[model samples]
Target: MFIEDIRNDFYNILLGNRVLLLVHYDVDAICACKILQGLFKCDNISYTLVPVGGISELKTAYEENNEEIKYVVLINCGGTIDLVDILQPDEEVVFFVLDSHKPTDICNVYSDGQVRLVYKDDEENIPNFDDIFRDEEDDENEESGSGREGLEALVERRRARKEWEERRHTLMFNYTQFSYYGKPSACVLIELSALASRLSQAALWAAAVAAEAHAALYVRSPARCLLDAEALHRYVAAARRHDDSTANRTACVVMEKDAWLPLYREWTLEAALSHAAMLAPKLKLYARSGSSRLRQLLADMGFPLQQARQAYRSMDVELRRSLLTALETAAPKHKLPVPTKATFILQRPHMSPLAALDAVYVIMALIEHETLPKAEGFQLALAALEVSGENEAWRKGSAAARRCLQAVASLVHATLSARKLLLAGPFSYFIVQDGTPEASVVRGPLWLGEAARWAAGGAARPLLASAATDPHTSILLGLPPRFEQEPRNLFGAAFEQAATKSGVTVSLDNVDTSVITLPTSQRAQFLDALTALLA
Candidate 1:
């Protein structure tokens, strides 16, 4: 089908249906949801926003709330996985997917018309039905208005339509055209808003969403950083105009004037809510209303008190304030500052581990704003040590205020002890080849990034590091710039040769720049052999 045909169908489906938005728990997802909310509000359509994490949570949400939902709109997620298989066999739920993740086999089968996917390449390679019907009509009209002039006019019209279609596709945020990691999901919604002829009002919100997504993904994926920079710049400029126009609004007034507001622009209310959703399980905030907490915070920051209370009710303002104060207090102590640099290791033992990662970036932004050198950058890595199950498990326990402190202490201790294996340089590393049980506890990419950042004296550099649980399993983190040429093949051959020489079963498991898992019993010997080869 042609792009126009699909768009027309989308509009038809959305004409009178209630939208149930199942969005992911990230900046991109939040931004996408906000864009949709704006569009839905503009069209006078009723919608509900439900923030979800992965497939399981989405499934649970669907099962519980399938009755009243007319259109299930999935943003940022549900593209990579086969949702058709996941849904009930007799379910009649129609999904409108606005995602950029790589599609699964179920997405390719056009026969399943229930799922209307508005992605980058959904129109590519498919027959343009408009052109086909247009040609047929032109042939019929040739009998009555048959002349060279008429034929020429038809050809010209076709050319114009073709050009418009090409331009429309060009405007889409296609993953294949750039980094292939997927564009911000909000980009797709923004395009839809354009097709719906609401772009003028929706563009600013869309751009802000894109900017937030870019800021959030900057450190996590270098490729995404490069890909999103131009879009972010353009959108931020557009969003500034909107921001300026809304400067007098209560929300804006509170956000801009809040003394406790984090320095980062991306750490806005939407981003915080998204992070809270992800950290809910760990923070024990799931039982409490996150929206209420946000509103209460705004009220405390001088937003209209009555309005804040009306918007967010059924929660104690004092309890919410206490929670916020605890998080603020716990954030600074786990931040291990380097001696002579603006670098810190934000090891979170009490906070939601991954959610605390967002806090680390916010801290980096603060450091950058305050004390970073004129031309220099700052590095903030994170490490989360395993606290006792009773402390880490927030759901089954109480006295979270006390547990938070204990968790931070455990994280700080683990981070300090892990600093012993440091090998500092431009290509810094921390070799965890000590076959001790204590060393095995520190795992994951976050730990690796923290180790590398520490070894480099908090300097931002391409790092090559390795962490081993035992002699048989080791994970290599970060790819140094010098080893970019044929990294996979080079690492593969080197590891093979090292394994052969050391007479141990050594092999590279999914070797890539960010991470490379090596399975071998003689990890120390393997590292020595590879180091000798590189030297």
Candidate 2:
């Protein structure tokens, strides 16, 4: 059943119950899980939180922790698949799912009472229950009745049912043809909690980071992100009432116009402008004249060459304050997009205010860290998101994010220079060879997705990028085209079809349908099949 009133139907229902919270391993899910945990703690509701990476991990976590868990809550997972079919929970056990992935499985959407979904997206055209289901009593009666005329009626009824079934199949195919994010699940939870008068700083910050995650990954549209954050602005106003800037070093959450560069505050401004995905291509940083053009842009903005090269934090205070104005006045002449927008920031006394986008990269690096177990990474990410100072683990994750961005820029430049990106019938693709310099860095789906976008340039088509893990296997990441304003990826369904049609051995273990693992031996055949299907 779909939930319309979250405070009444979802929050109040779990007030006194022991809940099993299974969260997926991702940046947005981590933030959403933290928000829920804070809300649960305040109400004195006992719950066990487990982070699951895929369907198999989800099942194992549910079975091991479901001792007396009658109310189960899943975040960013278990929505695309049938819950009852997979979990087989007891009849009394109710599942509350808050997943951003779409389209939601028909079984869950049409479930009677045991399952409840906490998301509502305006774009999703869910099928009507009558269109997809039929009553069994009528069929039984049609079978049991006896007579010549009755026999003819039964045949007619069966024929009608078959026609309805065929139509239902077509409707389902169209609905689930693409996989995309709806909104940040954390922001949804925060909005509902505020309706119940249960808002907190931690929850607001978490929601902010989750919203930034969507924008950073390009999984959600920029307009949608701003629309969803409208509700969050009210909370920020209330939270920012009395605290002065230097009061005991208390952390303050503020919304203000800042540069769109990812980590310009933490990193040097020059590096950020050159390597950030939003600015790199716009500045034509790959060409030989790119550097001189950048210097000229800065000079025309009245910013000194030395100040532009220095770390943003160490740059003169007056010049730092003038950046947004300078860019607004001069960036357009250089054919660059607007470089400033109002974003959420976590500011502490006598330190740099951390932007939501900056926090997203750090948290994501922790969750997908090469050395840490996913469960441990989840813990580290949660701790890192606190208002307090960063621990050693947090610092390590920040360093990793910098390296990852450098590798992404490196791979994008190498691919463009070598002309390795290939254009096919309906899509474009680039491969990271087995022993390439930055091949290992782009192995993770998130990194590869960033690389694919960078290499896509101005082409209005999906880009598929693969990184070889070994001679036998490679990992694939799919992204929407550059011109797609809403950014719904078609490759999720296309990958499934191509794998089956090509007879390739592939693994679809991740909750993200756009990522897949297949043998290197059959890469060509799989591409041929995918091209045909997409065409």
Candidate 3:
């Protein structure tokens, strides 16, 4: 729905501009280009599409097409400066940008209004100045442990803190967290790492996408981006405390206008640049996930972290890798993983029976593949039953349990689907009959034979029957009514009823009426009975 909103916004913006959309050749970029083109068509706006061959070609195209193009809308391209320079000062150029940002100088020029522009990074909420330096306690601890304390004590404490930080960072740097927590940088990382320990990539991504759509509507704020120097410094210090010395391997590059601020010595742009250079190559390695922070958080939340991790991995790999790393280094380490995946679902095993059933159903639904054997089905069913035992609805009537049974059936269907075990046939239905001990003569397993007669016999009789007095006509019933008399009497009555209904004489001299009882435990009698009859 939000994507639709974005498409509409693009259409409205294209009305006045002579648009030239330049996009990369990759699938994501190409899709974005087509979307933009569709919008232009819908609005009856004129537009030309350009495929980016390379950086040089892009620059050449920008220069050649400069005057007539009022807006160069770049989708999924970032850090293009030459193209920016070629655009007219008054023209409105919007970059529905992703993947990266513009060269800082180009951004500065645009900010100064040399050209009217809108860029994606700006649309995404950048870190608020107010949000920076909120980690005062972290700063205080760093100062006290490293500077105010005795030298050996400080060194020991810092070393211990650093180890803790790295472990936290590694766990937090998970992709699932990127989209979870409304894609909050910190929360996403924390969650992803937690999940990674338990889930595979595909499962986490599945959940992340679902959560993303829901969170987009319910959660108003996008993840906060980091911008302030002081906040970044604290972030770095916190990161340094982590065990992974690789956290120390990154470099940050800062460019400045000399007159803007003076006497700034604490966090030099040179030091940041040095850090960024150190990290460039290793960043590629970090892109490959280990135990991510996002995974960890989901695990803590009680989502099967293994499945959550799988869902996370199903996304764009680069984004997954980058998001995890960003989140990993942002937060302080806690021994316990927090904010579980199960938190998203309201029920748990210990809750009401309905809740328990719900929890079991959700977990089964979340399973990545059909790795569990058929025996697991019984275990899951038992869990569902236990969960439902406390449900007042189940006590009042079997409605709650019946609903749960249907839910379990759905999960079984999904499992079969995943395994590619589906059979090609008409819709499959089941019939279950249960009766009290006092009604044993005409109830319980006895009713199953009658049900079979109704479904396999009586239902067929109507479609196959011929004219009255036709000797070749046959009689069928879905089920023969239970007669508490002699078997002969029961059979005779059934024949008489069929004859009266169809106005045909019916004969039962050589007709066969069979009955069979099934051996099934009380707990699974319904399911087993159905299986026996169907077989």
Models 1 onward score TM values of: 0.41, 0.93, 0.23
* Alpha-carbon deviation at 298 in model 3, angstroms: 25
Candidate 3's C-alpha runs over 4 A off are 1-13, 78-83, 86-99, 102-110, 114-535
**Per-residue accuracy of model 1 over 47-83 as CA lDDT, tens digit each:** 7666554567678777777777767887766665556
Residue 349 in candidate 2 has what lDDT? 69
Q: Write model 2 residue lDDT over 267-380, tens digit each, in one string.
A: 787777777777787776666787898888888788887887888889999989898898788788998887888889988767667888888888877876767777888898
Candidate with the greatest lDDT versus the true structure: 2
> Candidate 2: where is the Cα deviation over 4 Å?
137-155, 242-249, 469-471
Question: Where does candidate 2 clash, by residue pair?
Answer: none
**Whole-structure CA lDDT of model 2:** 0.84
**lDDT values for all models:** 0.43, 0.84, 0.30
The lDDT, on a scale of 0 to 1, for candidate 1 is 0.43
Worst 10 residues of 3 by lDDT: 256-265
Q: List CA RMSD, all candidates.
A: 17.5, 2.4, 34.1
The residue-by-residue lDDT of candidate 3 on 306-408, one tens digit each, is 3333433343455433433332332124232111121121122344212211222222221211233323422232222222133432232233222322332
